[model samples]
Target: MLSDTGYPGAVGSDTYDLIDRQLVHALQLAPRAAFSRLAAVLGVSDQTVARRYGRLRGAGAVRVLGLTDPERLGEARWQLRVRCAPDSAGAVAAALARREDTVWVSLNSGGTEISCTTRTPPERADHSLLLQHLPRTPSVLSVAAHCVLHTFFGGAQSLVAKSGALSAEQVAALAPDGPETAGSDSPVPELDATDRRLLGVLAVDGRAPLAELAAACGKSESTVRRRLEELTSSGALYFDLDVDWRIFGLRSHTCLWLNVVPSELAAAGEALAAHPEVAYACATTGPSNLHAVVITRGARELYTYLTTRVAALSGVQHVETAPTIRTVKGPGPLPLPSPRDI
Candidate 1:
């Protein structure tokens, strides 16, 4: 079992040092890699790698889980901002987190703002979690939903890219071959029963053992391996690393909603993607055509980023910032149930 030295607490930079950061980057490459393999790749002992990962996991600083492509599952991903009365924001956010469909539930802007990402199925569109529930609650002041159109960059790969710990060669070695085709606009073939069962286990742990996964799906090891590869290549599934940035010296996370001229939306997104501090930036379908998540050491740093960095961008007319008070659900998708269960 892993030691609980940093468990159930926020680990500062002193507790999770530079070596821990490298290990995190390694996990970004192979989320479920064996300690021996990670040790060899990272030039550390197997025990060291294992211990580090244990402490990080125990501290709630990092998590590795399998995630399904929403589009492949024919689900819509929505970015939502909810405003509630000061006394009831926590209750509302907690309520949202309890629902199976919600992810990344966060309290922001003191205690009155809640931001979250929700995956809604087509059948539940009219009766969505927030839509169906929030309106009935008197505490909820207003809610706005933005559809996630195109993801230029986010998730595990983007996290590692911002780390700058690995050299180009190391990155190349860690990168999976072929492009990310998940959530493609082109038609995706329907997933079969076996495919759904296989995805169920993977959603819990992306790097689950071949034999274990084969048993779960009632298939031979070789068959399961082939199917896993096929699913990845075909864009049916993908993996992401989930971790808190505070362990890496980034003590604050803030989301920036920007109103950029329509013509410059793409340009602004591309520019935000290049910044190391910008973890996620994409175009959405609201007045704030561009949405960005940024990490910094403190309020002062965040202020500088807003004034000097973000303001420098052309065509940016308005900017709204909300600092994350707490994260209730995930930095990545929660484990999805099997299709039948859904």
Candidate 2:
């Protein structure tokens, strides 16, 4: 157990892994689940859960926060395809990724496009505001901004499920037809090589035209469309509307990692994540028990936020903020190579 001094050495890595997977799974199952319920179901003491969770936060493995809907909150989302000069893509991407409004950023096709997601604040985040930062960045050849109409991936869930611990019977008992399988937080559908390839493409560009994706995957657009529909329906994939965060007057981004009193974690987590500033929240294995990515507009705004704001919530024992200097690779499709791909 971390001493009051915060040694963080009492909980070992093995213990953290077991609970971390379980925590994410539980979250996958129910985003707003209280820690007490999760601990009871997972068969661990609440204090242990809290201790280990603190460790996970220290490890930067997970975060718990509210997934705000920008459109509902009166903001717009955009995808920027930035083209930079040779060897300059990395630098340009680094600069662009640092802004609080830049939620997601990545380089693809050997850096031809530095893809990113940004929220347009109601007053300051117009298309030109986006370009305004790039000209000063150097080596920014061109920038293409696509207004996001739909999302196929990357929305934060209130909870996650761990399919490893729960049996098919248990899943059926809890939520038989909800959305996921007993042992898989990932929605299930049989995907062929082409389907996997298509996912890879979408991971980079959810807006990839069906014709383009089909050509890359060597399939027809109709076949691609039908397959995509099946994948989404089966819950293997989800759409992302990609709303912008800035317009809603959300001006700051802070990562809040807390070690809640596990006995009260269940109720506390739900209440804490549901708070307004929390934009992406998750419960994971802990040393940093809970990780919450918060948003606000400026320094003064954030100062008012934590001091006059979130500090009032109950069950919060510890909170730390890491001003995000950059998001190297923002959350999107986390597709990975199967064992064979190795």
Candidate 3:
């Protein structure tokens, strides 16, 4: 079985050394920064930075992914909660994981509940899997779809950046060049064919070399570089690092479904967003208007957080905690497990 660290039975492999943590934090700030740039910022040799990243990637502990902001693309993002027959939960989750539109698929609630996030383009909203296939599945007992209204945290934000592995100066030094001031009112740039092709390659590997991206998108390197800058600057595309939290000594992962007074929803969400334990938090349309993913050291720590920090939040009427049993997919594409592993 894969251990909590997402490594296959590697004892003590989850603990990242100081350099490793620093490197991760650096990448969290600038995911596509050249190795030489990262090394210089981290005060290490370029070879060392590259070697450490290679090791982390080979161990399945980290991945850099370039993802489009669904809101910028005028797409609807949904958080799906599916309750299934106990025996079919794993299979159902596996199916969801294989879908390109779905991410963060996990088994929860004693292997009978599945939670996932899916993006649906406006053109396909009526025909989405949430609207059609899941409701019709015999094994699915119920499906609750929550439309994400606003994100208080997550997306380009990384927990690694909050680790304090790098100093303020280091973070500033590695920051991408540009004035990123895109707001809700910023004009959404329409993506063309080349832009789509470029994003397709980056979706798999955010750090893919410029030459490779140019070839895949059928554009010159200079054009590809300029287009990438435009997309990022416009807040249409952002890079994220998918890493196992256990590497940071966080061994427990849970989803928090909270019902808060509508008047205080924004306040509560902003508060939760500030907590280090929260990996993702957003406002959604549902009985539980606020949802968050939290990471902690273990079950005991999770309990403490709920009893202390979470309990201290104002206007929370109800809270439901669903600890993840296993992740079927994360932010990046994940290989399906073998039948034996499943």
The TM-score values for the models, in the order shown, are 0.87, 0.44, 0.94
Give the Å shift of residue 240 in candidate 1: 1.0
Name the best candidate (by TM-score).
3
Q: Candidate 1: what lDDT?
A: 0.75
Arrange candidates, best lDDT first: 3, 1, 2
Taken over the whole model, the C-alpha lDDT of each candidate is: 0.75, 0.54, 0.85
Question: Which RMSD values do the candidates have, in order?
Answer: 4.9, 20.5, 2.4
Q: Candidate 3, which segments miss by more than 4 Å at Cα?
A: 1-15, 335-342
Give the lDDT of residue 259 in candidate 2: 67
Candidate 1 off by > 4 Å: 1-10, 72-74, 122-124, 177-189, 332-342
Candidate 3 Cα lDDT to native: 0.85
List model 2 lDDT by residue over 155-196, tens digit each: 634213312445554344344244431223434565568876
Better of 1 and 2 by TM-score: 1
Q: What TM-score should be assigned to candidate 3?
A: 0.94
Question: What's the lDDT for residue 66 in model 2?
Answer: 24
Question: Which of the predicted structures, 1 or 2, would earn the higher lDDT when compared with the native?
Answer: 1
The Cα error of candidate 2 at residue 47, in Å, is 57
User: What lDDT tens digits, residue by residue, belong to model 1 across residues 1-342?
Assistant: 111211135466677777888888878776766899778877889999989887876565676776766766678888999999999998898788777678778888987999988888766676456567777887999999898876656743455557877777766766666664544565565678988778777765666799989988899999988877777666666677667776667778788999999988888888888887898887888888889888888899998888887988889999999988777666444433334334
